[model samples]
Target: MAITSANQLELLQTAEAVAREKMIDPALVVEAMEESLARAAKSRYGSEMDIRVSIDRKTGRATFTRVRTVVEDEELENYQAEMTVEQAKQYMANPAVGDQFVEEVPPVDMGRIAAQSAKQVILQKVREAERDRQYEEFKDRAGTIINGVVKREEYGNVIVDVGRGEGILRRNEKIGRESYRPNDRIRCYIKDVRREARGPQIFLSRTAPEFMAELFKMEVPEIYDGIIEIKAVARDPGSRAKIAVISYDNSIDPVGACVGMRGSRVQAVVNELQGEKIDIIPWNEDVPTFLVNALQPAEVSKVVLDEDAERIEVVVPDEQLSLAIGRRGQNVRLASQLTGLDIDIMTEEEESKRRQAEFEERTKLFQAALDVDEFFAQLLVSEGFTNLEEVAYVEIEELTVIDGVDDDTATELQARARDVLEEQAQRALAHARELGADDSLIEFEGLTPQMLEALAEDGVKTLEDFATCADWELAGGWTTDNGQRVKDDGILEKFDVSLEEAQSMVMTARVLLGWVDPEELEQGNEDEIDEDAVEASEDEA
Candidate 1:
């Protein structure tokens, strides 16, 4: 093979054909040909020589060149490709250290081995360009639905032929035991697009919650128009699913619109999902209300939410318990996922028993802490005074409002409660000091003596230790582990320390220890306030 006048136009013709076949830019194919020709030219010439090739896009002519760059005397390692400033004077009137001298060179007459190597190089370059083109084309298409034809199955994974690329649907991403044969048409969600050594990988999914949401979007015009929004979706793949939707337009009912006229719209989605049962619920800003709707077909007698823990307790009638929990707890699990909360469902009788137990426990605490009789402690408990702190610091009028309790009785009650609290505090302080608590921690304004004891027991004896602690470590929190909520116990949680209070106390400790700059903290707060104000104004608009 030679770059003769007869074959010069053939190179561009071949490049155009290859580019058309690969669906890539003709310029890229031409560039690949130039690179391959340069590689063959290097073999014909000295390997150290800097050989270059250029193809004229319009004329289809090949130009080969030898390039030698001027360099400092000590930097001229490549004798054929680099020239010292002084040696470069022979080639030009004046040449600087960074100048390059180019001379036209004869094209190579490639032998059988050289031509074969050049062909491989061109093929590699074309493949790389194709991969890049595919990656660029599909990267933005992620999180969307695509129609493809199933090509084959490797092990348990299904390979689909998308228009310009191949998508892989892993066994785990398939709905249930769905199987496909060659040339079977399939609809899937483009879960991800990645560039790899082999090629661009387009991962497809049929079990993604977003897939169901997208299906509804496709079937519902209101959703596509943004009149109705899919707020949340939870699915058990091909078995059961729940979707919560909200409507911005007051006239449009989100649930009804999603269900469509005579269940036609939802039915379309259901058919695509392989008969997956779906419960469409109206989205609500109130979490409990949304949860009640999520756990549909079950009558909720009462709802108790622990906001800080992100946990909810639902009391249903005994007959509805099984219905709320579903078969194998699937209903509650889907509801929890839909609402993003950990739900604990119980019967009304169970809730009553638990409440009675709590009441008895509070009465016991009051009786022991205040040195009051059972009836008096029960009365205090019934008045909503759960702890000695409330009884000690509450308004005199609040205690006086209790039956048979006058101002004098309230005053006596408060006196005794405060004395007991003081004694308990002193005992806690002594215990904390015994456990090697530092004065700096004990003197911290926000932490009570009991808090110090708890901290000392937890090995946080110094202000530095407190400063190093995260807010959740002192306030307790719920963490999602393996899709289940796990409780993290906090040392100060028993003292009813809220997350916000813990954050403030930790920040205060850090400031006192000079671990954080007060000015920077204040500036951050100001920035947050400004951002919040801007958001508030935007919401108002």
Candidate 2:
């Protein structure tokens, strides 16, 4: 039936009825009416039109008023177009060019266009208000499970009514192999709430990480109480899931608590997830160990990390390779996601081959570059001395204890190694001094000022000291105060430096000592020994 004046009154009453039924505030209807009327006037007459709308509390009817400006000029301003100065004088005397005027728009006939337009505006306003209400209702419930009645499926997405609003469970968010029927009461986590032109859009998810986290929360009170912290979670939705958990209190086992007695707690979650399996593993700060746990049912022998590449190579026994890798690599794939690493799974045989290749390469370098004999090389291999560092650093005493290596052999080998090391050290020192180490040399406790002076006189100013003296002479004795020649070892003890250190000192000392003539020393000895022999020869002549 056409809505007559009586029908309009009934419409207002019906609006009140619907508002009450929906638990919607009646005042919101009045506000919506005002807004709708204002919007209609603005749309029809432009916003420059000064219009105000008032709503009746009892009848819910709307009244409109138009405002104008009083002005001196007969030409009406936008706000004074409907009024004359004489009409505006009652409200404001001595009206100026910009003065405002007020009047009520005459009650127009209830034409189809105007009435229909107003009704449309009121309906739109009501919908907007309803949408806002729904948004507020659902926003606070985010991250919690809500039981929803399935409305329909559109484009593979399930539309569900969540009491006050409709939520969309997108196809991508639905668990694979899980089914639902219309009107089915399924529980979903409220992932988000958003306002739109039609209504509030509540987005739901069945595959979110929080879904599993919430399942644990429901089963384990400790999780809700904050005693346990869910460090990270990985899932395949309906198949299997891995959740890493930790407990603040040392006494509680997070995995055990989450599992519950006879698996009842976890079973409850599993049933809700449609018989999906769950592994509640304890979290560890150690990355390798955490990764091993993440790849459960698969035994991991060891995990080798390549930090720069952000990858980890996991070694599994030949028997467990398939288990560790899982069907179609799902196990290792989820583990990679959980541990945040690119995991490469390998069998013991493969890793052993890699280790063997590395060893062979190192051995080749030792044999080719270091001239290490087969016997000594085997000893180095057995002793874990794979690199040049071990050979260069092995002590003489320790080397002497090895079979076929006596004290003399050990000493000679140590001396050769020392020579190589000293040469390298001198070259480094020279480079360092070139790079500004002149002042830093003073910090060397091995080089005393007295020793430096002695070296200065012998023309042994720098590592260049090797240029003037033989290795044996530089490696030889130091002169004592009683004119006795003490060996380098004795001179080394004076400064608490080693023989190699004394050699470095001797290089410097040669410069300080300068060169003494051997011929002059021989003649001086003759002068002291045979002044009498000279006289006897003169007598014989």
What do the candidate models score in CA lDDT, each in turn?
A: 0.94, 0.72
| Number of clashes recorded per candidate | 0, 25
Off by over 4 Å in 2: 1-15, 21-23, 38-48, 58-62, 69-101, 371-541
Per-candidate TM-score against the hidden true structure: 0.96, 0.64
Candidate 1 structure quality by residue, lDDT tens digits, 1-541? 8889888889889999999999999999999888888999999998899999999998888999999999999887999999999999999888998899999998889999989998999999999999999999999999999999999999999999999999999999999998999999999999999999999999999999999999999999999999999999999999999999999999999999999889999999999999999999999999999999999988898899988778899999999999999999999999999998889999989998998999999999988877889999999888888888899899899999999999998899899988998998999999999999999999999889999999999999999999999999999888879867788998899888999899999999999999899999999999999999999999999
Worst 10 contiguous positions by lDDT, candidate 2: 483-492
lDDT of 2 by residue, 405-507 (tens): 8988766665665566566556655554444433433344456554444444444554444335453443344444663334343322433444455555444
C-alpha lDDT (0 to 100) for residue 128 of candidate 1? 98
